[model samples]
Target chain A: MGEEKGNVKWQMNQKCATIGFHANPGSKAVKTRVSLFVTCIVDQVFPQVGIAMTQVLERLGYPVDFPAAQTCCGQPAFNSGYPEEAGIVARHFLNTFRDSEYIVVPSGSCASMIVHHYTDIFANEQKTLEQARSIAPRVWEFSRFLIEVAGVEDVGASFDGVVTYHDSCHSLREMHIKEGPRRLLSKVQGLTLREMEPAEECCGFGGTFSVKFPEVSGGMARTKIESILKTEAGTVVSVDSSCLMQIQGAIDRARLPIRTMHLAEVLAGR
Target chain B: MTGQPSETINQTLGDARLQLAIYSATNRLMTHRAGAVRADLLPDYQELRTEANQLKKHTIEHLDHYLELFEKNVIAHGGKVVYCSDSQEVADFVLGLAKERGAHLIVKSKSMTTEEIHFNERLEKHGLEAVETDLGEYILQLAHQRPYHIVAPALHLTRYDVAEIFSKNLGVENEVVIEKQTKIARAALREKFLHADIGVTGANFLVADSGAVVVVENEGNARLTTSAPKIHITVAGIEKLIPRAQDLGVFLTLLGRSATGQPLTVYTSFLSGPRRNGEIDGPDEFYVVLLDNGRTKLLADPEKRQSLYCIRCGACLNHCPVYRKIGGHNYPWVYSGPIGAIITPQFHGVLKDPWLPFASSLCGACAEVCPVKIEIPKLLLKLRSEVTDAQRRQGVGGVERLAFGIWAWVMTHPRIYLMLARIGGIFLPLLPKVGPLGKWASQREVPKLAKTSFHQWWKAREVPK
Candidate 1:
C-alpha cells in the first residue's frame, strides 16, 4: 500500500501527454520547455542530428532546452561489463536531468540504457534505484516521443531523395519503435521510402565489440552494406548514430555510392 | 585487439567461400522456418512456444525427481541407466563394455553428446573401429574437422570439397554429384552397420512417463543405428528430460519447424527398451548414459539456468549474424553459434574461452528465434560480467580496468570533457590512427567531429523567443 502511494506521486510528476504513463495530459497546456538529452556521440561526432531534432521540436510549438552539464549516458561502459564505472557516470546523468519536466533523446540505445537497464545499474542501491525509476518513464526516444507521446507526425519536413530505413536493434526490439519512424518519413514532402529486406539486422558496431573483434565486425557490416545497397536508395536512415558510424565507415571503405543519416537529421531538414 | 584474446576468428573470416556457404544455408533455413510458422499458417504457434517453455521450466526445476522416475521406468522396461560425470568416465564405461562383450566395431548415428566427449578419438586410440552413419557427419569425419553448423554439420563444404575428401579417404574417383557421393558413403557404411557390435546415438528428448528416448532426424540413419546392432547405447546430457509423454507433441511440433522447417522429420523414433519376444529387429540390450559433466553447475545458477531449456534446434544459429560471419569452428568447442557462446563458457569455464561471451553484438536475433525463449543476450551480458570480474579479481586485465576508469571519470566531469572535446575536434583529423581509434579505422574511416557541437549551436541560437 505504501509503495503504491509513493508510485502514484511519482507518476503525477510526469509532464508528458501521459496517456497511460501517469495522469492524463489530455487537457493540459505545455508551459514547461522540453529538455534535450543529446547523446555523447551526437554531441561530439554528429551534431547535425541533434540540431535537426531541436529544430523539429521548436517547429512543433514546444520550447527546447539543452542541459549543458550532460556528458554521456554511460552506455559504452555499461554494455562492456563495467557496471561500477557506468554507475558513476549514470548517477551524474540522474542529477543533471532530475528537475526537467520532459526529457527527449535523439538516440534509441542511450534512451534504452536509461529506461531498461537503469534498474540493473542501480541494483545494489535502493536510493539510487528510486531516482532511476522516477526519471525512466519520462525519458523518450526521438521517433517514439513524436508519435506516441506528443501525438504529432509530419512535422512539415521535406527531403528530395529515395531513402531506406535501418532499424537499429535497441530501438526496434527494446523500445518497439517500428513503423512510427516510417510514418514520420511518409509525411515528408519529397521523401520516397524504399523498404530494405532484413533491415532489422545488426550493423555490428557493438561498442567495444567492433575493436575487440574487428574482423568479425567488418564481416557483419559488409553483409549489412549489401542489404542497404539492394534497396538502391540514395541514403539509409536510422534512429541511432552508432550503427550509422559503422555503416558509414564500411561504405567509405568500399567507396560505395550511398549515404547514412540519422532519423532526426531527416526530420530537421526543411 | 591487443587486450582481447582470440582462438580463430581471423582465420575463419578470410575464407569467403565458407562464409557464403554458411550464409546461404542459414538464409534458406530461415526462409523455410518463417514460412512454416507464419501467423496465418499456425495461429497457435505463440501459445505452443509458451507451453513448451513452461513444460521445460517445470521439468528442469524438478530434474532430480524426474530423472529418478525415468531411471525406474527404464529399469521396468528392461533397460539399464547409468550416470557418468565426465567424458573419461563415459569412455571408460563404453570401452569396458566393449572389451567384456568382445566387440570390435561401433557404429554411431548423429550424437552431439559423443562429439562433445571426443568419443571416436578415444575409441580409435584403443584400436576400435567406430563409423559415423549420418552423411554429413561422415563427410566431416573424412575431412577431419568439427561440425560447421549444428543441424547441418557439413554445410560449409562444397560438393567439390566432398569429392576431394571422398576420393582421398575411400580411394575412389572424384564424384561431384551429391547423389552419387551419398551413395558412395552409404555403400561404405552399410557393411559396418550390419556387422557392428554396438550403436551409439543422442536423444532429442527424454520422456519420463514412458522412459523413452525420442530421436528426430530427417535421415533414417538413427533408426538403423538403433535396430541394426545388438547393443544400443544413448549418450545424452542430463538436461534433456521432459516430465510427461504428452509434452512430446509440443516439442515435436516445434523441433522440426525450428530446425529445418518441416512439419515433422522423416523419422521420429521412440525407443523404450530392448527387443521383446516377437520384436526381432530391436537391440538386445539398451543403455542410457546420462551425462552431467557440468550441467549441475548450470542448474544451480538461477540467473542463467534458462540456457538449459534449449532443445538444440539450431534455429538460433541460423538467425545469428555473428555466427554466420565467423562460421562454427572458431568457437573452440563442439557446440557452436549462440547456444555455444553461452553454454561453452559455463561448461568449460570462462578462463578457457574468455572471448566467447564477447563475440556477439547483442542484436536480439538469437533470442527472437529461440523456440525455448532463452534470453541469450541477457545471459551473455551476465557471462561478460563474470568474465570481466574474474579477470579483474586475478589482476590480469589491469589496463582495461584503467581505461574504463578514465572513461568514467571523464564522462562524469562535463567541463573537462567539453574542453577535451573541443581540443579533439580541432586536432583529431591531424592525429595519426592509433590505439582504439586506429583500431576502428582499420576497416572503415573514423568519424569526423563537428566544428560546432550541438550544445554550442543551441547555446548560441537560444534567443528566448
Candidate 2:
C-alpha cells in the first residue's frame, strides 16, 4: 500500500498489528529480557496497543514476556485515598513481577504509579516497602523503555498523517517523559508532527477526577479537544491510555474527525 | 461557611459570564507571571526562592523563638504587640483599644487577616463606622460583599458591576469607565482616611529583628491608612513572621513577581513602629495583633506545616485549573485556590469539607509557581489521606470503603479481574445511567471494551522456532 490514500493499508496494518510475532532485529543484537505489564486499560479496552508495543519491542531485539498473573497497578485506589486497599493490590503487583529483570508497561499512568508512588503506598510495611523499592527502578514506560533501555530511536515505522501529542499529566510531570515520545515520533517518515499549544496542560482525565468533577473535567477535555483541533492534526497521541480515553471520548462526543491513538500503536506501524 | 463546594462549583460553571471572567482574569495573571519569570528580569529568581524557602522553613521550625524576638523588638521600637489566641481575642483587643481611646470612624487598607477576624463587623456592632480605604476593599465595602479574590479582592466584579454598585450605594451617577469609578472611590475614602480615629492593615511580612510590618500594595492607600490616622493597628497571622529585615529582600522580590507581575508594587512601606521623635504625618499609637487562630495546629504537624510558607502571592490560584473553574467564593474561607485547598482543611480540619482536597486534579502548577516553594500538591495529597482517615475513624465513607475494598480484591486476583472485565464489557453498555457514572457518561462516552483481552490473544499464538 502507498503511504497515503489507502484504506486497505490502514485496515491491513491494524490486523497485522496483533501480538504473537517474534521478529528478528536485523541490525541490532538482542540485549535484555523485559516483562510486559500490560496495564488493565490496554489489556481490556485497547488490546491493539499492547500488541503494537510487543511488536515494537520484538523489533528492537528485546525479548518481552507477558506475566499472566499481573493485573491493575492499584493506582485508582491509591489516588482515591484508599492506601490500604492500594497497598494490598500493590503487594500483588510486586509479587507478580518479582522475578523479572525489567518490567515495561505501555501506560505511563500505571508505570508512574508503580515507580513513583509504590514506596509511599507500601510505606510503614517493611517487607512491601523493600519490595517496592527494588521494583521501582526496574519499571519503565513504553517510550522511555524503548529510548532509554532498548536504545532505539527510529523503530522503522512510518505513518502518513498529521498528529499532535498530549502530555499525560503523570508521565509529563512525574516521570519526566516529555521528549522521549516526540524524539521517537520525529523519526517516523511521512509523519508531520504538529506541536499543540499548552500541550503540557492536563487533559482532565485524572483517573476518577473525570467522574468526580465531570463539569470541570468535560470543560478541560473540551479545551484540550479545541487545542488538538487547532493543530488540525488527524490524530492525537499520548503514552497513557487513560488520557487518550478521556480526550477520545470528548472528540467522539463532539463528533470531531480526530482520532486518538496510543503512542505505541503509532510507533509500531510499518 | 458557604454552600457545598460541589453545588457552588456547578453554579459557577453554569454561568458563562462568570466563567469567562474568571478564566480571563486568571489567564492574564498567569501569562503575566510567566513572562516576568521568563524574561530573566529577576536575575537571581531561583536563588531567591531557595533562600526564601529555607528562611520560611527556619522561621516556622523556630516560630516560638521568632515570635518572642518579634514582640521584644516591636516593644523596643515603641509598638505594642498583643498575642491573640483566636479571632475573638483579636476582635476584643481592637474593641477595647477603640473604647479606651473613644475612637470611632475607622479607615482600613486591604487586609485578609482583618477579614479573617471579622474586624469591621465587630466594630460596626459597637456602632462605629469602619471604612475601607483601599480601592478594591472600598468597592467591596460599599457593595457589602466579601473579597472575591485574594490579591484583587473584587476581581469577579466587572467595571459595569462596580458602576452599578457605586450608583446604588455611593449615590453617584453610574460611571461605566474604570478610571471614573476609581476617582469616585478615592473622593469618598479620602474624607474617611483624614477623619478616621484608627487605620487598620494586614502585614505582608513582620520582620522579627527590626519589628517592622511590611505592607506591599499598588494603591498607596495602605500607606495613607497608616499615616493619616491617629492610631494604626496591624492585624497579622503569627505565621507571617520572618527572622530579619534582610529576609524582606528575598520575599519582596518574589511577592510582586508572583502576585501582579510587578517588579515592585507602587508602595512597599516598612513601618517599624509608631511615629518616631519629630516624625511628620504618622500614627501616635501602633499596635500589632499577632493572631494564632488555628495556625499553631497547622504548625504542630511537620508534614503539613510547609503550607504556612505560602506568601499569599495567589500565583497558585491563578495557575490552578480547579480554582479557574470554581472561582474564589466556592472555597470555604477567605483564602481560596490551591493554598486554600491545603490550608482550609489544615486550619479548619478536613471534616468540615472533606471534598475540598479532592477538588483538585493534583496538577503541580501550584507547586511550580510557589514563590516560597511549598510542595502544594504533596500537601494536598497528604490532606486527602487525612480526610479519608477522618472518615474511616468516624465510621463514615462506608460505601466508598467497601467499593474500594472489592475493587482491590478483584484487581489482585487476575482470574476475577478478567472475568469482571469480560462481564463488564458485555453489561456495561446496558447498565442504566445513574449517579456518578451517569454524570460521567453525560458529558463523555465511556471507553468500549475490546472483544478479546491482550493476554488471551498472546496465549493463543503459536511459538515461533
Candidate 3:
C-alpha cells in the first residue's frame, strides 16, 4: 500500500534487512546459518533495511534465508490483551519458521514476540502451544545472535562518527542482551561510542501507544531524544530499528543534527 | 483533615499535565530500576521475591518477640530503643531526648516515619532546628512543601522551579544550570551536616538479630547525617524489624534493585550503636525510636497486617497506572498507589476517603511486582467493602448511600437487572452529555449491546436444540 502500512511486506522486508550481518562462507569455521524472519515493520516502511541486511549478511560470510510468508510474532495484539489476533499471527510465524535451525529477528520487540508472547498467544490450544514453545527456544535477536551465537564481533566495517546505543526495553530487560550490541559496536574501527546516562529508559513508542496516547508517547520520546542530545553524540544506534525510527522521526521533526542507525548497519560498517 | 488532599480520584484522573509529570518521572525510574537489577546477574529473581515475602511475613508475625530481642541487642551495644504507642508519644520521646541532650540543630535524613509523626514541626516548635539533608528533601525544605514522590521528593518541580526556590532562599541568582544549582545546594547542606548537634535518619530495615538500623541512599548524606553528629537518632516504624540478621541480604538485594533498579545502592550502612573508641567518624550516642502510630491497629487485623511488611521500596508507586495518571498527592495521604489505597482508609478511618478504593482498574500489576507479596488489590477490595458498609450505616440522606443501596438490590435480582439494563441500553444513548454519569461515560465509553438480552437470546437459541 505505502512505504510503511501493512504487515506482509514489513515481515518480508525485515527478513531482507538481516542479510548485512551474514558471515563469509569460505572464511568462517563456526558456520553460522541464520534465517531472517523480517519483522512486520521493516517489511513495510523500510524495505531497504531488509535489502541492506541481505547484502551485509553476504559480506560477513553467511547465507541468510528470507521466510517470505511470515506475518508477525503476535506481540502487538497479545500485549494489547487480544489473544485471538495474536494467535493467528503466532501460528503464521510458527508455520514459517518451525523447521528452521535458527530464527533471528531484527527487532527486540519482535524477538520478545517470539520468546515470551508465543506461549501465551497459544495458551488455550495445547497442540499449537507445544509447537510454539518448541520454536521459541531457537529465536534470537540479530545483535544477540551475531555476538553470542555466531561469535562475530567485528564485522570488518568502518564508520567515522560518534554514536550512542539506546537499550530497547524488551531486549535490555526481558532478553538480557545488554553486551551483545556493545561487543559488536566496539570493533567498528573508526566509530567512537559515547555512553548516554540512563540509556535504558523506554522511548515510549509502545506501538499503537503512539497513535492511541500520542501526547504521552511523544512526551516520553522527547525526553529520550534530550537524553541522547545530552550525550553530544552525532548518532543514536540501537539493535531494534523501530525505536531508531521513532527517536529519529522526533529528531528530524525537531531538525536536530543527530542521526539514527540500526546496529546491523553500523556493524556492517555502512 | 489538616492539609486538603485531592478532591476525588476521578477529579485528578487523566489530567494531562499531571500525567506528564507522573508518567515521565515513573517510567524513567522503572527503566533505571530494571537496568540495575539486570546487572546483578541474579538468575533466581522470582525466588528472591518469594524469599523476601516469606522473611517479612515471618518477622512481622513475631514482631513483639523480635522487638524485645532488638531492644536487648541495642541496649547491649550501648544504644537505646524507645517504644512509642502513637505519633504524639513518638514526637514526645524525640523531643524529650533532644531536650535532655540540649540539642540545637538536628540534621535529619528523609524519614517517612518521622514525617508520619510530623516530627520536623514538633522539633522546630521545641526550638530545635531540623534541617533536611537529603537532596530531594532539601529542595522540599527550601520550597516549604511536602514530598510528592517517595524516592524523589522534588519530582514535581522542574529545574527552573528549583532554581527559583534556591534563588529566593539561597539568593544565588535564578537562571543557574542544573549542576550549578545542585552545587549551591550541596555546599549549603554540607555545613549543616558537619556542625549539626544531633543527626536523625529513617531505617530501611531493622535487623533485629543485631539491633542495626540499615539506611540506603545514593547521595551519601545519610551516612554523614548519622555519623558526623554527636547524637544520632533513627526513627523507624516498628514493622521495619526483621527476625534474623542473615535475612538482611535477601531483602537488601530486592530492596535496592526494586526501589531504584540498581545492582546495589551507592551507600548502605548498618549502624548498630554509637562509634567505639577506635572509630574516628561516628556519633557518640545512638537512639532507635520504634514508633507505633496506628501500626499496632494495623497489626491487629490479620487481613491488613501485610501492609506492615512494606519496606517502603516505592515499587508499587512506580508500577501503579492510577498513581502514574494522578500523581501521589491525589491519594489523600503520604503513601499512595495500591498500597496507599489500602492503608489510607485504615489510618484515616473509612469515613474520609470513600472513593479511594474505587480508584483502581483492579489490575493485579501492583501485587505482581511487590517484593513483600502484599495482596494489595485484595486489601483494597476489602477496604472498599468496609467503606461501603460503614457508609450504609452512617450516611443518612446521602445520595451515595441511596445509589449503593439500589446497586446492592439490583445485583441481588438478575431479572430486574436485565429489565433495567434493557431500559438503560435504550435511554443511555439519549441522555445529554452533562452531569456526573455523563462525565464518567465521557472518560470511558459504554459498550453497545445486542437488541435482545443475553438470557433471552440464549433461551430462544436453546429451543431449537
Candidate 4:
C-alpha cells in the first residue's frame, strides 16, 4: 500500500497526460504555444519528411516551429547505457528547446526521450527535473498529435499505392501511437492500404544498434522486406524514417525493388 | 563472432549457419510483428500493455490461491494434477506414470518446458520411443539438433534442407519443395500420432480457475497430439498458471498477435481434463505436471520475478538482434533469446553461461513485444550481477581475475584512466600495425582520437573570458 502510494505520488508529481501521449493538444485545452521537434535523422537524411510534418501541422492549424540546434534526442547514448554521455546530450537538447510549449517530433524514438527519458535525464538537478516533467506532457509524435489531439483524420492529401506501414519500436510499444497513424492513413484518398504481416515487430534499426549488431539488424530488415513483398505493395511505409531506412537498406542489399517511405511522406501525398 | 565455449555438449550446434538461416526467417517474422503493431493496433497500445501487465501481476501475486483452485477444478473434471518441485521429479513422475500404464510409444508436440526437462532422453532411457508430431520438431528430430527459435522450431532448415532430410530419411527423391516437405512430415508424424500410446504437450496457459490447460498452435498437430493418444500428459512451468479463464481473453488476444503477428492462431484448444462419458474424441487420462524447476526461486526474488510472466510468445526471440546473430545454441540451454538470458541462468544456475546476459544490446525491444510485459533486460542484468557475484564467491580463474582486477583498478582511478587513455591515444595506434594487437585491430577500425580529450576540451571551454 505504501509502495503504491509512493508510485502514485511520483506519478502525480510528474505532471503529464498519459492519454494520447504522442498527441499534441490532446483533448485538454492548451494555454501555451506548440512547436515541432524535427528529429536529427529526419533533419539530416530526409528533410522532406520534416517539411511534410510542418505542412501537415500547418494544415491542422498548429503553429509548429522547428527548434534549431536540436541535434539528436540523446537516445543513442541513453539506449547504449552511457548515462553520463546521455546526460550531456540531453542537457544540450533541454537547453535548445527550453522555451517550447509542446515539443512534437516526427520520430517515436525522439518523442519517447521527452516522455520516458527526461525525468531520468534530469534526476539530479531539481529545477531542470521540474522542467523535464512539465515538458513531457506536451511531447507528441506527429501523426499521434494529428489524429488524437487535433482530431484530424485525413490531411486532405492524396497518395495512390498499396502502402504498408512499419511500427517503430518506441512509437508503437512505448508511446502506443498505433491506431493514430493508421486512423490518419485510413483517411487518405486513393490509397489502397493493404496490411502487412508481422507489423508490430521491430525493424532491428535501433539507432547505433544497426551498426553495432549489423547481422541481427540485417536479418530483421530482410524479414521486414519479405513481409512487404508478401503484401505485394510497391511501397513500404513507416512512421519512423529509421525503420524505413533500415528496411530500405536491406531491400537494396537484397536487390529487391520495393520502395520505403516515411509516414510524413505518404501523408504528404508523394 | 565469438566461438562457442567448450562445455559438456560436444559440437555446440554444428548449426551456426543453420541458425543464421533460421534467424533470417525469424527476422521476417519480426518485421511482420512490427507491421501488426503499427497498422492494426490503436495509438493507445501502451494502455493495453499496462493493462496486460496489471493482469499478469494480479494473476502472479495470487498464484497459490489460483493454483489450488485450478488443481481442485482439474480433479473435479477428471484430470490428475502433479506439482513437481524440480525438473528431475517431474521427469520421474511422468516416467513412473508411463511405466504404470505400460506405454511404449509417446507422441510429443512443441513444448519448450518438456524440452527443458530433456523428457525425450529420459523416456528413451527407459526404451520408450518419443516421436515429435510438430513439423518443426520432426525436422529437428531428423537433423539431431535442438530448436533454435521458439515459435518456429525447425525455422533454421530451408525447404531444400527439409527435402534433403526427408529424401535421405524417408527414401524419397523429390527436389525440396515446401509443400512436398510439409506433406511428408505431416504424413510421417500422423502415423506416429495414431500408434502412440501417450501424448506429451506444452500448455500455453494453465488456467487456475478452470483447472484447464490451453494450447495455441497454427498447425493442427497439437489437436491430434493431445486427443489421439489414450493418455495425455501436459508439461508446463508453474508460471503458466493464470487466475481465471476470463483472463485468457487478454492473453490470447496478445499472444498470437505479438508472436507471429497473426490475428489468431488456427487452433486454440482448451483441455480441462480427461474425456467425459459422452465425449467422442479426447484423452482417457489427463496429467498436468506443474514443474517448478528453479522458477520458485526466481519468483521469490522481486527483481527477477517478471521472468515468470513470460508466455513463451517468442516475440522477444524473434525481435532480438543478438539472438539473430548468435542463435540459440550459444546460450547453452533449450530456451534462448532475451527470456533465455534471464531464465537459463536461473534454471541452469548462474554459474553456467556467464556471457549470456551480456549478449543483449540493452535495446528493450524484448520488453516492448512481451505480451505479459516482462522486463527482460532488467532481469538479464540482475542475472549478470548474480553471475558476477557467483564468480567472485567461486574465486575466478587466475588470468580472468587478474585482467578484471587490473580493469577494476584502472576504472576506479581517474588519474590512471587519463594516463592510460593519453598513452593509448599516442602509442596504442602506433604499435597496433604489427603482432598480436594487429590481429585484434585487423577487422576493426579504432576510433580516431581528438587533438584534445573530452576533459581537456571541457577545461578549455570553461576557461571563459
Candidate 5:
C-alpha cells in the first residue's frame, strides 16, 4: 500500500515480484493449449513426477504440449552466478516456448527461473527482454495452474496417506502460492493433511549450494527431516522436485520410512 | 570470526553445545519477534517499513545536502563534527582527544561502529583504558572476543560459559545463575561510569533537521555512558541520517520490534550537543565522528545502496537458516547474517571477502523480516555476480565457466540433451561420490534416475494434440 515517494522509483524491480500470478478464470479461454516445461531434474531423475503432472492437466480438459526443445530454465547456472551461461540457456528456453498459449512448469524453482531470472538475464537485450516479460505472465507453477488458472479445487483425485505439504521457497514467495496449494490438498479424497512445524523452512537444496556448502545444507536437511518425523506423517508432498530430491536423499540415508512425493503425483493418485 | 565460513561451519557443526546455544538463543528471539510484529500488534507495520525505506532513500540520495544541514545544526548546538575517511582516522581522532584531555578511563555503550574500527583495542593499545558498559559488550571485552551478534553480542555463550568467563576474568564465583551474572558485570561496570573521563556511543538515527543522535537501547547503561563523563563521543556511519525529527515515529516503531522484539526500548535518548549554560547534567564537550569506511562506494551503486538502509535490527540473523546453522563466529566481520553477507564483501571488496554472499541460500527470510525492507537476497545475488566477475578477472573459475559453457551447448540442442538424458538414466546411479556429488552425498543419499524419463514417455505415448 505504501508506494515509493518523489518519482525516483526506488522499486529497483525485484526479480521475484509477482508479474501476473493472479487468476481470472472466466476471462481466459479454457481451450487454450498448455505447454509443460518439465524441469531437467524432473525430466531425467524423476520422470514420474512429470507424467503425474501431465495426467492431471490433460484430465482437466486442456491439451498439454511438451516443447521437446526445452532443456532447462537455467536455474543451476543462474543461482551459481554463471548468468552469462544462464543467459545462453535461458534464451533458448524463451525461444522454445515462444508461441505456447499457457506455459506450465512442474517445479517451482524452474518456473521462478522463467518468471523472475529470465528478465534479469535478458536485461541488456531489448528485444529478448520484451519477449521474456511477455511470456512471464503466462507461466504458472503446476498446482497454481490447477487452482487459480483452471478454477478447479478437486481434480477428482484421491490418495490415501497422512501427507504434509512442503512450501518450496520459490513457489511460496515468488508465486505467492500458500493456501492455494493447501486448499487443493484438502480437497484430495482420503488424504489426511498433517502439517509439519517447519513446512515453510527450506530443505537446503539451493541448487549448487547443496554441494558448495554441503555441511550447512545437510544440517538444514537433517533439521527438516526431524520436523517431518515429529509430524508422524507417512509421506511428504511438495510443489518442487528439487526440495523433494533433498528430502528424499536424507530420508533414504536416515533409513526413515517417510516417502517424498510431488503434489502432482499425489493428486494424480487413484 | 575465527576462520573462513566453511572452516568455521565445519568446526561449529562438531560442537553440539555451541550449536545448541546458538539455536536456543536465535529461536527465542525469533519467537519474540514474530509475536511482537504480528498484524494485530502493529497493524501498519508494513507501511511503516515502506515509509522508513523511502525516508532513508531520500535522505541518502541527497546525503551531501543532509550532511551539510546536519553538520550546521550540530555546530549551532555547540557540538564538533569530524568526518573520518576510515577506521584509522577515527582511531587517530579518539586517541588525539584522549591524550589532549588527559583522559585515562573511557566508558562505552554498545556501538557497532566503534567495534568495526576496533576502537577499544586501539585505545587500550595506546595505554588508555576504555571499558565497555553494556553487559554483553562487557562480557565480550573480558573474554577477548569480538561482537558476535547484532542485538546479543554474546549470543553464542551460555550461563555456564558466562560463569567461566566471569570466574576467569573478574575472579568471581563460577556463578551459573543468570541474574547473578548480570549483577557481576553490573558491579564491575558501575565503578567505571563514575571514574571514566570520556563516554562513547553509536547513534541509531542522525536527524538532519535537528542534528539529534537518537539512541534506542534496552539497558539504561547508554544513559550513564553518555551523561556520566565530561566528554561524550558518538561514532556513527554516514548513512544513519534521516530528514526530520518527526520521522522518528516511523523508525522507532520498527527498530525495537525488529531488533529485540520490544514494543519500545527502555531508553530512547535524543542528544544534540553539549550541556547549555546552567544545565545540571550532560557532557561538557560533544563530538560526533561520522565514519565513511566504504559507505560512499556502496552509496554510489544505485542498485545496492539499500544495504545502507539497515537499522542493525538483528531480525535477519535470527531468521536466517544459514546463520542458524553456522552461528555468528563464522561471519568474518562486525555484522553477521544477511546484512553481514552483503556488506562484508562490498566494504572489503569482493576480492578480499568473496565467500560471504554465497553463504546464503537466497531464502529471502532476511528481506521478509527487515524493518527498512532492504532486498537482502537480491543484493546477495548481485554481490555474488560481482564476486564471480572478480574471480574471472583474476583468471580463476575457468573450469566452472567451461562446464557451464558446455552445459549451455548441450541444453540448447534438444536431441543431444535427450540422448544424454537416456544415457544418464542408466549410469547416473553409479556416479562416483566425489567432488560436489560426494559433498552432497555426505549426509543425503544420491537419487537414482527414473527408469523411463518423462520426455521419452511423452514421445512414446500419442495423445490427442
Candidate 6:
C-alpha cells in the first residue's frame, strides 16, 4: 500500500512536468514554481484545458507542479448554500497547497472562490481565516497569472479562426478579469477576435442553477447563443469551462455549427 | 401565493406573447435608463448614488426618530398622521376616514404600497369605489389583475390586449391604435377624477423636516389624485422619509434617470398638508397613513435594513436577465424583480417559497444597476442561507445535504475524487436520462467526458527533450 501510494505521488509529479514544465532536466533550479489547481470541471470534462494551461505556463519558463492531493476548490458546495461542507473541502484545499508559493487555477470561478469566498467559508475559525487570506492573494486564474504575474502578453500562439470571448460572470465581476483574456487573445497570430453583443452578460450555467432552473437556464443560454451567433464567430471562447459547457450545450441542442474553446486551448494553439 | 413561484414562472415562460411583451418593455426601459444616466444628463451619477445611499442609510438607522419628526411636522402642517402596524389597520383607518367624510369614490395614482396593502380590494369589499386613474393601473383594475411591472403596471399587456380589455369592459371599439387607446382610457378616467370624493395616493418621499409628501409621476394622475378632491389620503410606508427637503435633489436626479431614463418626471408634487386656507383645487382634509407592515421586522435586522434604502427605481428589474426571461408576474408580488426577490423572503419568510431567493442567476447586474447600490446578490445569498437553515431545522433538504456531504468528502480526498471521475466517465453515458440529470439533459446536451483526463494523459506521456 505504501509503495502504491508513493508510485501515485511520483506519477502525479511526472504528470505535472509532462508538458515541458521543467526548465532543465533533473535540475531543481527555476525562477518560479506554480501549483496547478485544475478545477474539477476542467479536470474531468475538458482535460485539454488543463493540458493547454500547463503547456502555456511551461512555455513561459515556469516549472509547474500538480499537487496530487488537490481535488476541488469547493465552489459547488459553497455556491449551493452548504457552507459547512464547503468549509471542509476548502480547509483540505488550503492544507494541500499550504506551502506553495504560487497557486494557479485554469478556471476563473474556482480561482475566485478561493480568493474571494474561502475566508467566508472559514470565518468561524481564526487560524483558517488567516490561512485563507494568505492563500487568497497568491491564487491567480490562468490568464491573469500569465499577464499580471508572469508579465507575458503573447505566448507565441496562433489559431486561424474568427472567435468571440464570453466574460464569465465570476471572472469579470469578482476577479475583474475583463481585459486579461482579451489582451492575450489579441496577441495571437491569424486569430480574428470579434466582439459579441452583450459579451459581459452571463451564459447562465451558474453551477447547479442549470439543473435547478433548467428552463430559465436554457432560456439564458439561448439568449447568449443568439448573441454569439450575431458576432458570426466560428468559435466561442471563455475562461470558465462551466460557462463554455452551458454555451456548448445550447449550441449542440440548436444544432448550430458554432464551436466552443477555452482561452487556454486557443492560446496553446493547434 | 406561496411555494408556487416556479409554477407561475413556468406558466409565464409557456406564454410566448407575454414573454415577448415583458422582454421588449424591459429592454426598452433598460436602454433608456442607460442613456439617461450618461455624462450628458448626470455627469456625477456615481457620486449622487453614493450620497443618496448615505442619506438613506442615515435615515434608516434613525428611522424611529425621522418617522416621529415626520409625523410631528405633518400634524403641525395641518395633516393628520395615523400609524398602522399592519395592512388591516391601514384598511380600517382608510375606511373609517372615508365613512366619517361621507366619501364614496376614490381616485388613486400608482402606489406600490397601496397595492401591497390590497387597499383597492379591501375598499371594494367595504362597498367603496376605488378607481385606478393611472392608465396602466386603470387597465389592470378593469382586467382584475395585479400590476405586472413596478414602473409599468400593464407592461405585460400589449396594445391589442388593452384594446380587447377596453372593448369587452368599456364597450369601446376600433381603439386598436396606441394613441387612440390612451385617448379612450383618458376620456373614461377624466370623469372619475372630477367626481372623486377622496383622492388616495402613495407618497414617493416624505420630507421629515418640512412635512412634505413628495409624489413623482409622468401622467399627472398623481397630481390630480392628490388635488381635485375634498379629502386627500396619502398612504406611505414609514421607510420613505429623508432628513431634509434638499435631499430630494440627490434622490430626484437619480430616481427618474434610473427609473425610466428621463431627466425629470413631468409632475413632481410636494403635498405638505391639506390645501392652504386660500389654495384652490386642493383637498380640504389631508391624512397620511404610515404603514409598517413587516417593515420594522427588516429594520430590526441590521444586516438587511439596507433593503429599505430602495428608491423603487425599478432599474434593477429592467436590467435583470432573469426578470427579462421570467417577467414580473412570476414573482407574484406588488414589487417584483431583484428587489422583490430580497424583500419577499425577508417579509414573508423563506418558507413561503424557498425557491424565490434561488430564482435569480445572481449575475450581479441588479447590484450594478441599483441606484442606491443595495448589495442585492449578497442579500440573496444571505436569504438563501436562511432558507437552507430553515430547511435543516425542519429536517428537509436531506437528499441535497447528503449529496453535498458526500461530494465534500470526495473532493477532500484526491484519490477518491479521481477514481469517481473515472468511474463516472465510464458510466455517466450509460446512466438513464432521468431525475435531475435528465432535467439537465432535457434542454441541453451534457458534455461527454474525456477518455483520458489531463492527469492520466500527462502521467502516461513522455517528457519533452
TM-score of 4: 0.66
Chain A TM-scores, per candidate, are 0.90, 0.89, 0.86, 0.86, 0.89, 0.88
- How do the residues B1-465 of candidate 5 rate in per-residue lDDT, one tens digit apiece? 112466667999878998898888998998888889999999999999999999988988999999999999999999999999998998899999988999999999999998898898888898999999899999999999998899999999888989999999999889999998999888899999999999999999999999899998888999998899999999999999999999999999998888888999999999999999998899999999999999999999997999999889899999998998898888888898989999998888987877778887787778888999899888887887887888899998778778888999999999999888888778876888887779888979998888888878888886653
Model 2, docking class: acceptable
* Window of ten residues with lowest summed lDDT in model 2 chain B: B1-10
Superposition error at B191 for model 4 (Å): 1.9
Candidate 1 fnat reads 0.80
User: Which model scores highest in lDDT?
Assistant: 1
All DockQ scores: 0.69, 0.45, 0.02, 0.07, 0.51, 0.46
- Cα RMSD for candidate 6? 6.7
The number of clashing residue pairs in model 4 is 20
Q: Per-residue CA lDDT of candidate 2, range A1-270, in tens?
A: 333434665444434322211132232433557899998889989999999999999877777889999888998887787878888898999999998877889887899889888988777889888999888878889998777666678999999999999988788777888999999999998999999988988888877777778888888888788789889999999999888999999998999898999999998898
Candidate 2 C-alpha error for residue A156, in Å: 1.9
Candidate 2, B159-277: lDDT as tens digits: 99899999999899989999888899889888888789999999999999999999999989999999998899999998899999988888998999899888789999999889888
Local accuracy of candidate 4 as per-residue lDDT tens digits, B259-288: 888767999999989999988989999999
**Best candidate, DockQ-wise?**
1
List TM-scores of chain B, every candidate: 0.97, 0.97, 0.92, 0.89, 0.98, 0.97
Off by over 4 Å in 5: A1-29, B1-5, B463-465
lDDT of 6: 0.87
lDDT of each: 0.88, 0.86, 0.73, 0.72, 0.87, 0.87
Q: State the lDDT of candidate 6 residue by residue for A1-270, as single tens digits.
A: 422434765555455444323323333333468888888888889999999999988887788888878778887877777888889999999999998878888888899899988887777899999999998877889888887667678889999989999999889887888999999999999999999988988888888778788888898999899899999999999999999999999999999999999999999995
